[model samples]
Target: MANIRPYKISISESQIQDLKTRLSLSKFPDELDNAGWDMGAPLADIKRLTRHWESSYSWKTAEAELNSLPHFITDIQCDGFQPLAIHFVHIRSKVQNAIPLLWIHGWPGHFWEGVKIMKPLTEGDGVEHPAFDLVVPSLPNFAFSEGTKERGFALAQYAETLNKLMLKLGYNEYVTQGGDWGTHISRALAHLYPQTCKATHLSMDAANPPSFLANPVLTLQHMLTPYSKREREGQSRTEWFTKEGRGYNLEQSTKPQTLGYALVDSPVACLSWIYEKLHDWTDNYPWTDDEVCTWVSIYWFSVAGPAASTRIYYETHHTTRTPENPRAVPRDMLRAYSPGVKLGYSHFPMDLVVLPSTWVRTLGNVVFERDHEDGGHFAAWERPGELVKDLRDMFGKKGGAFGCVKGANGYSQ
Candidate 1:
């Protein structure tokens, strides 16, 4: 493995200027009082967030912080012709003999979830995770990493990219964690290279596929009761979300270009699109306005929103889709106490779900499941401290545990 090279973030002044120019030029349509998000970004909220993004948010601070953490870009050759260059932050354990941990993030979010975890992993002194080293990367076309230049950039290919990344790092064995697309891709990694990925932790999952025609794995309580308390409040909200959220999902998968205008044109639109997801997933528990800005800032200054979400959709949509090998690996679920999507659901709670190859064969051992008292889909950001603790504890105790982390109590055992 090459000695880790020092890398700097590449956000240009011109790009920032272009973004501001675009935001300044935004021609918002006139909206009557109480006219809501039915059209898209709410005028009231978008105006407020745009004002802050243009005036107060500092890209340099975030960029420097990202730079302070170890970062690198390396290529992996596969179905994708050009050696795929992946962007990652490798946080070495302050103490020697740290375990190596690979973290993959979902769409609409980057490595930022795992990027800032090293400090907590090392317990303020970087002395912890002595048994672990952290690797967090932005998926192709998402962040700094360029998307595949070739014709075959599928989710499975992305898993292979991860495999090469691990081998390149000289790690024959390591653990993994993810949610959303990360959940499926990590599963693909384990299935593609189980020897290299010893065990994986996921933040989204359920028991394996239906065991019988009549009796499924789902519990009566689960089927009868709402997925979460907040969901039971109203069926109308659930219906509205289904109708609306599906449009975004379908467009992203089928016709990403259709929605690109608003997202690609206005920084305000871009921020709203992503921020709303984060806000909803975390149950919108009154986050600090700046708390919302950090995520938007990453997408804004980097100028990587519309395309980032689309590429993931593109790759996932076009991947090795077939009946012979429907899914690649097992997914563990870490259910957040109150997530918005859970509020809007019928049978399936998530949007894009892929079952594994061993899905029907090994139901019991495959899916690791757990529920948390706090946090939702964006666990890493909303509840980093808790996320870290759970990750350590889960992995540490797994006589066959999937994901593990411990906070003040210590996951080191």
Candidate 2:
């Protein structure tokens, strides 16, 4: 058993100086006239951001704000992999029977994504809403957590590390909330350890159309029902992503190392790469300069170099490519339904992969579903109140997953 120790964020003065130096020496590429986001992150935007990052940004202030949160580090050892030092933010509710929820983050995102909802989730109004004990982990190789040296650390390993951490914290059974890569990871946790992961709530809905052979009832329903207005619009959005927005996926999946050099060497390269998604993936969320820099700074000062984060794409893509590991969860299984665990889905209009309600139903035993006119991939950060509300309603007294976790009804006696 690894001891859990209190942790704080304190980047050294030399690191801060080095970042400023890199920002000062950045070389930018020229763009065609009037080429906005169509040609990638605009030269003007990157230059302005680089200037601010070099001069005005205060990492010390950001560090102090992050330190105020309840941060901790623990060792989580997955089978065949060495013990990894996992960094996380754990907040226990005053309500004794609060639900234990594991919140995981995806690429280009860290534990800070959940900071907005932490207080509201744990300190819910006693009568109407439900409170929760939240456990947000910086997935290994993403942020402060230590990275893996060996190969084959795919989705299963990621799921295993999180499940063990929950068990180590005495959360014998729990629910989850996540988006982006998080959607896949939470589903993997439920599939691998159904007894421990009782339910999951997701923002991203990536599923294949129902098949007549495997999903007779769902296929029949799909044939009978015409697409709703929202569903029709969602298809157009999905088409746009498949055609225009998926270059990063192919690059990361096939040749992340080639691109890793740019991300590791240039601060602007890292910023522009992430900033583009933060712009396109969201539903017009206005981002400040400091906000963008702070988000990128986590990657700049990540425990593992920024390059390590992209390996998940390659590893997961090749997970079941060999014949020996036939049972390993592949791309298809990630979209397939896993019985036993309850599910909740939140659909956002601007998310990269937006599927219809029927398609999403094929993923699990879905009990709660909601569609929002706005918001996008970064659901928790863009719309914390809405995301938190979905969780509360899913686990509240009248929810489908009510009483799923023993004694964690999220109410006061």
Candidate 3:
């Protein structure tokens, strides 16, 4: 597995030039008159982003910033075959009190999402705060990691890979925090490896109901609540996407070969697809045009586009994540008014998670629950300090229970 050929970014001046050329020449879609994002990625906004991407963006600068941290690549046996190598960033907190913390990003963002919190977390912001030896990994194929050849890349698939990553690095025990898909991964990890994965936390820890949560009247009440706004508006913008946002997913699960062509061939197309989501999903806080472009540019240079993200989507929808064997560890859940942004962006259909508490109860122990005054979908990227601070406090408490094997009662089964 160590011999799985290492791969780093190889974007050249010429490749950047060609990417710019394509962005400059690409034909855009016809819009409804006076239509803006109500149609999807307003033409004017897309043009503005395209112009900046073509003229002023520099991949080299971003590459250096990314390389400032330590990075490595290695393969973890997913099952029978030697799949694509996992690219990860490991930043160890020098503080003697540091707790082992592993952060995961799902779709939309890459390992880059967790970069902001690295220094403040590990460097010990204050005088005597314990540092966190961080293990931030790019989910297989989202950014720098290689694509998997497995049939589907679901939460279970990721859980398997992560288990190997921890053991490979001699981390028999660790703590995890995540938001979107990362949140799901955390749950799966806790359920699958309750012993090694000491505790789990999620910003979106809503569970699916037996079918009553979708009753017409109850669903209507959820829609009006502004909390489920994003999904509601998401469905309106992209008619097909609202049905679980499965357009790209279908291709990834069935014909990844065909989907890879468009993503690989047109760099601009990939950016347009992914960048729009960052804007559409988040509550649209702590992100500006420049930051948004930076995230998208990373993908362009890394060339870890449509294929990898699609695999995540394919793997998630196809995997067996839901089970009766309830999670045994404690969980901390934060609901950061994410639904409002999804609704305000456009009228897309949303799976409004009305009661995250009741939902999370099905999976595992939920110790802490707070509706964060700030942040939305990408909490780590949007509010790194707060997210890291919460993690530190939570992990600090977990450290207090270092030797205790069972979760404190009244948490979860």
TM-score of candidate 3 relative to the true fold: 0.76
Cα error of candidate 3 at position 63, Å: 1.2
For model 1, the run of ten residues with the poorest summed lDDT = 338-347
User: Residue 178 lDDT in model 2?
Assistant: 96
lDDT of 1 by residue, 1-413 (tens): 57445567878888878867776777666778887656666778877877776777666676777677778878767652576567788876654445567888887778886754657765433223224578887777677776654544666667887877877887666767777777677666655665666666666542343333423443333355444433333234445556665566667877766677767667776777786676555544566666567666666554244555576565466555358545422223212111111010111222223222223123223333333454556656666666676655554444234222222112343
Ten contiguous residues with the weakest lDDT in model 2: 321-330
Q: Please give the CA lDDT of all the candidate structures.
A: 0.58, 0.90, 0.60
CA RMSD, predictions in order: 6.9, 1.4, 8.0
Best by TM-score: 2
Model 2 CA lDDT for position 294: 93
lDDT of 3 by residue, 267-385 (tens): 66776777767765665554566776778876765535555576665545444423532221222212211111110010112212323233334344444444454455677777777
**What would the per-residue lDDT of candidate 2 be over residues 283-375, giving only the tens digit for each residue?**
899999999999999998999889889999998998883576543677777887899999999898889988878888988899999888889
If scored against the real structure, what TM-score would every candidate get?
0.77, 0.97, 0.76
Clashes in candidate 3: how many? Answer: 17
